[model samples]
Target: MQDSAAGAATMKALRRRRGLSLAGTARALTNVAAELRLPALPAVASVQRSVARWEAARPTRPDDRYQLLLGHLYARTPAGSIAIGPGSDFAELLTALHLLGEGERRTAELRTAVLRAATDQGAGMLSLLSPALQAQLAAALADPARTTDETVAGLAAAVADVNGQVGTLPMVRLQLLLAPAVDAARRLLAAPVPSAPLQESLREAAVAAYTVAARLAFETRDDEASRAAYTAATREAAQLGRPWRQAGVHMSHALTTMYATHDLAAARVLADRAVRAAQRGESILVRARAHALQAEMLARAGQARQVDTALRLAWYDMEANHAGDPAVTSFSAGHLRGFEGVCELHVGDPATAHDRFAHSAAALAAPRELVQRAIVTVDQALARIRMGAPQDAVELLHQSVDAAAATGGRVPALRLRDARQALRPWRQETWVMDLDDHLLDGLGA
Candidate 1:
């Protein structure tokens, strides 16, 4: 729930980045204190209370020892900051707070950028580490206490919180955190099996983490890593024996085959597998997501009739309010409309696709939803070209290049280039030449 940097970074964000809950962080620090035989340690509750106050995420900053211990806890320095910004604005504001010497004021914040920006952009901002702060976070990761019911719950909650960030972050940076998260879950799972329910919870967390990792891999064009991660996720979910979780895994893998490899046959296999798993599961939301994925894949293959049937099934499942569904499903009216739009385009109905894309544009207009909007913008541009308006398509494509670049949407950025090539029939147009120059500039080509 918390966002923003304190003095360059917030302990809370760094703590969460390492897969610790507030209490887990406190306990980790306490454990570290015990191992070092440092003075009488604060009780976990007392430490947790302090951790909450420290999370004010203002420039008041934690003093030296606390900062060093946190660095040790997270296994890194530059532990002082997290993302929340209009770069220049946050930089200036953080500077002003430091200049005044001290104060605690909450600022509205967001981390979508941190997960989307280049890694150096995110962690490199906190470059003020001292020699004394160097320490291993591995100890805490190994602590038997980390697998307690409360801690396991924290792990689940942490991953769920992260998935909430999908569509906002860039594929590269999101994969960074997901790897650590999956590692933390693996640590818990490797511990001698706990109570059956806790074991199941750990498996689900591992499966969820692996699935998302695979998804990001798909986005980043790391086909081998994506494939390996999907395999791990499926193996774990099969052991968990939860149809819904396994279904989620299959649906995500479907995305990889559909986009990363563009292997229609492989995508079809995963989509069908997802639907079968969803059918055996209880969540309509999960089933809806599975079928929607099937519909989207079918759209890509230009299978009009099959796409229509799958879409109808997806919409039917979505009609109900399935409370407490996993955030990973990510289904919405707009998503379905976008799927239909893509289907219409593949089926050679540009005018209908344009309308559907318009609906998609509205749905993805939120400021943080830039990547989705950029993707839809490209589709809309393609539709425009198909409808005999290369100029309009060129204009839209220009804006999309910026959006896609800013959000680390390498895939969409590549698509923007391809969409520009679609204007070859109008190659003599001056605006098309202008668009070419702009694309070159954006690409540093």
Candidate 2:
């Protein structure tokens, strides 16, 4: 008789034959577990290593829980029929009978029940809003009210506030603040307003609102919402005939493609389009920001020489323009340096990245933008890890985590996860374990 290792090999072969990468398989398992209401799902890296061990003919076999999940995900027969060449693991045989008997059917019913419950809860919440609030919302959606000069001025101040809050407020909080404003602005744009000057102001305000809305969505990982907001912003900017506003929107869209979607080719095209649009605009600030965005994207693509050239152009443009519109451009010397550091990190220069992050950290410390501060701290931590200083990396990561907790930002949480993954090799170390435990507790993971 053949060994049980043959069964493990078959499972590995099946996964490969289905054209699923290790990450894809892990995601499938996770989704199935969630649907089945499993108590816990395995990590992606854990699943990857388990697959490798299985293929290597290790003693370990897929556990009962994993067996059920994999079977459902791959549409395989019940566990009882799963053959391992000859003899099965005692644990596998013991659980197989129970799993095949009634567990499978019960799990399917539980998944359906969970879906129905979720749908019902969502409907109930929507129906819970006050009647007056619902009527006002309906009116805003159906027919927009006309805008006045005072309203436009108020909107401009709100845009400025939104701009200032970018690296300070949590993304969810920002989204909550911007959503109603964006809706109101959209309605005002649709309503008939007699004053041409007021109409222009309203359009500008709408563009600003839409741009902020897009940024909020992007930061929160809502790609479709971000894209829709960007589209709306671009349309408003075009109607306002403001090349600078259009350029700003294009730059933001480029960032969304680059960071959010990870489409390098599409990001490059949008970045170039932003530069061209900025060049056509009268505002030097627009040109400066466009160049800065181009530099950041080029750095991510590992185009080192082009990155320096783009950064240089950005600096030149900023120097040529003394004044910048706060609502239009957030470009500054310190912010540019932060981007330069990010570029250096991507270009594989950890030392330079560390130095640049240090500078940015110091510069931002005075104003104390919690989100930006956390980002720079995490970047520094990553650089330190790359430079083979795990201890130093741990310290910086702690700072970043604290900053993130203070700001209630998801970006910091994501960076912390990356740091944790990078430190996996040192998992057995007491300090590393403590740090991991701390992170899990704090992040509510």
Highest-TM-score candidate: 1
Instruction: Give the per-residue lDDT of model 2 (tens digit) for 225-253.
Output: 98999999988898876787788889888
Model 2 regions lying over 4 Å from their true place: 1-146, 324-329, 366-368
How many times do residue backbones clash in model 2?
0
lDDT string for model 1 (36-70, tens) is: 46675678998877677666645335444554344
Q: For every model shown, what is its TM-score relative to the native structure?
A: 0.69, 0.64
Clashing pairs in 2: none
| Candidate 1: stretches off by over 4 Å | 1-140, 167-169, 327-329
RMSD of 2: 21.5
**Clash count per candidate:** 5, 0
